[model samples]
Target: MDSMQNAPSTEDTQRTSQPAPVLALLPETGVSYIRHAWQDMLSGMKLARLGATLGWLDIKLRYRGSILGPFWLTASTAVMVAAMGVLYAYLMNMDVHKYLPFLTFSLVLWGFASGTLQDGCTTFTSASGLIHSARMPYSLHVLRATVRNLLTVAHNIPVVVVVFLWFAVVPAWSWTMPAACALWVFDSFMATFLLGILGTRFRDVPPIVASTLQILFFVTPILWAPELMKTGQDWLLLDPFFPLMEILRTPFTGDIVNAAIWPAALGWSAVLTVVTFALFARMRARLAYWV
Candidate 1:
């Protein structure tokens, strides 16, 4: 009778049979996203050799069947600089020796800066075939675009050299020139990273980027000397591009760059880096789907 009483526990058996709750998986936090983004960039940088090779191939394919190949870039740039330099010097009543050197520096650097950003907008979109067909870090495409533009800039360097020699102008070559060049390269990567994501997601971005660059080219001191601006001269310091151009141009032209401009340029670079990195982190995961 005691054994039968102990076995009469259906309620206890039913309670024990119930399943325990499963813990829900947590969503990814911002820190994790940033970490992953950093990994992606590092992985891409590790593939720099591949990126550079592909970039070189791009140059070759672009000018295939041409006699001068990449040297065509140097020749065309020289012709344009010569024509613009003569016309602008006469129009502005500035000495050709001084004006031509300044113009050469301005145009070459501006071409690099503008080309980087403009190409940045097509970084991922142009590589859609590779992205879909292969498994690689999205940043590799960004590096590829940056490398291509850098190669283009290298081809244009001869133009700068010829202009300098023609005018008998010796470069002041400062430590800051290397620093500025490094900054330009770093900024190019950041820009390509940010714009690549946006460009992949939005089809209209490239046109808008191109149009904006065109407008900036006119307002920037590429065609005219900053010293000519008597009014709102202080506002030129506020122009983000002016400081960048000044820091780079001054070292080559032997002109004095205001000490204040260095801080401004660094500040702008920091702002661009931080903002682009954050966006890249947030968008990194979505890139594959978007592309």
Candidate 2:
């Protein structure tokens, strides 16, 4: 009777045997998201060699059976440049010798910029199979798309060189040229990352981007000279593509780049990079799910 009285009650034993409460699943904070994004970007960059190889293979497979391979793009661009250069020069009443070089530089650079963005839309979606099958940094796919477009730009260099020789236009090399090119490259990566995320989330994004690019091409000073805009010459500064193209084209055409262009280019690049990184940080965790 004494032992039974001293023994613990059933309620007390149950209370003591129960497990401790677990903490709830908390959401990631802004700081943690940014940290993860930074880590992902760094990891992706380290795998650039794999990205480059895949990009090269993409080109090879695209022209597998063709004898001319990627040079077909070069030939077509050369032919288009020849035909359009002569026709537009006459139509605009501009001197062909002066106009062709500008047109060549503009078209080649525009192609690189536009192609990279367009391909950026498919950066993640196109690799959905690989993305699901293997775990890798999303930025690697971004680099792959950028590198592919870059290779196309490389193939088109011969066309630019031939035009330069035929017209005897001497490029005025400057420190600004390399600086502008580097900025352009950096901007491409930022744009690609942003576009890749949006594209993976929305299927309509690719068509929308393509359509917008088509409209921008005509409005941009690609086929005509900026000097043709008599009244709104200053408003050209409002055009996003203008500063980017001018900083690059000016150095190649032996023309003086406006002092204001560098600031504008840098400004645009900074804004793009910041916005892209922020959005990327916010969405990085959801990318695999979206893809």
Candidate 3:
């Protein structure tokens, strides 16, 4: 009886030892999120090779039983370009030679960019099983998705070559080709990381994004050239995706890339990188639990 009376109460112990359980779910501060983002970036760089291999493996498995394998993507793209080139050129009253090359490059590059972003929305959640079982950098998943689509893009380049040769079109080499591609990668990575995190939590974002992309495909200058709309040049510039697309497409088509595109694309990449990193950092700790 005396020992029981002298013992500290369970309520007292619980009250003194911990904060309220609800407080645990509260969002982290800005500084903490920034720190998490920085660590993820460093960790991701350290594991880039692993990500690349995984990405390659993914490509191989994706076409494991197929005869043509990855080339199937190229063939499919070629057929679509052929059909669209004929139909759209007639509708728009543009020269077939001019329209075909422009359409070919636009569609190919768009596939790379759009595919990366769409797959990115599933980055973490799709790999939730592995993420839960293993201890590795989460950013590696984003890298793998990006690299996988990049390989797919590389495989599709032959189609572009065939188009160029058939039409006797010689595309000029520009310094902006590599520059724009580099910036685009940065934009793609951040988008994947950001959307992946949100997707895991919301569960609705993926479908929403898919729907948005479908709508965007029609509105984006994929089927029609921006130069075709001279009165709406300013409106075309307002299309956030066009500037990014044009950087690569212009260089490939031997057109002078707009000077404004460089700064615009760079600025877009920088902003997204910063914002996505911070969001990733803030949510990094909760991913495993949420998934």
Best by lDDT: 2
- Report the lDDT tens digits of candidate 1 across residue range 1-291: 989987948888988898988999887798999998899888999999999899889988998999998888788888989899999999999999999999988998888888888888878878888988998987888888888999998998988888788878877777998998888888888888788878888989889989989998988899999988888876777777899999889878988888788998999889989998898898877777787
* Candidates sorted by lDDT, best first: 2, 1, 3
Model 1 alpha-carbon drift over 4 Å, by segment: 1-26
List runs of model 2 lying over 4 Å from the truth. 1-25
Model 2 worst lDDT window (10 residues): 232-241
Residue 188 displacement (Å), model 1? 1.2
lDDT of 2 at 24: 100
TM-score for candidate 1, please give it: 0.89
For TM-score, the strongest prediction is 2
Backbone clashes for every candidate come to 0, 0, 0
The candidate, 1 or 3, that scores higher on lDDT is: 1
lDDT of 3 by residue, 1-291 (tens): 999999999998988899666744666678877777788778988999999999999999999999999999998999999998999999999999998999998888888878887888889988998899998888899898888888989988998999999988876786777887787787887898889999888889888988988888888899998887778665666667888888888878888877787666666677788788777877889899877
Ranking by TM-score: 2, 1, 3
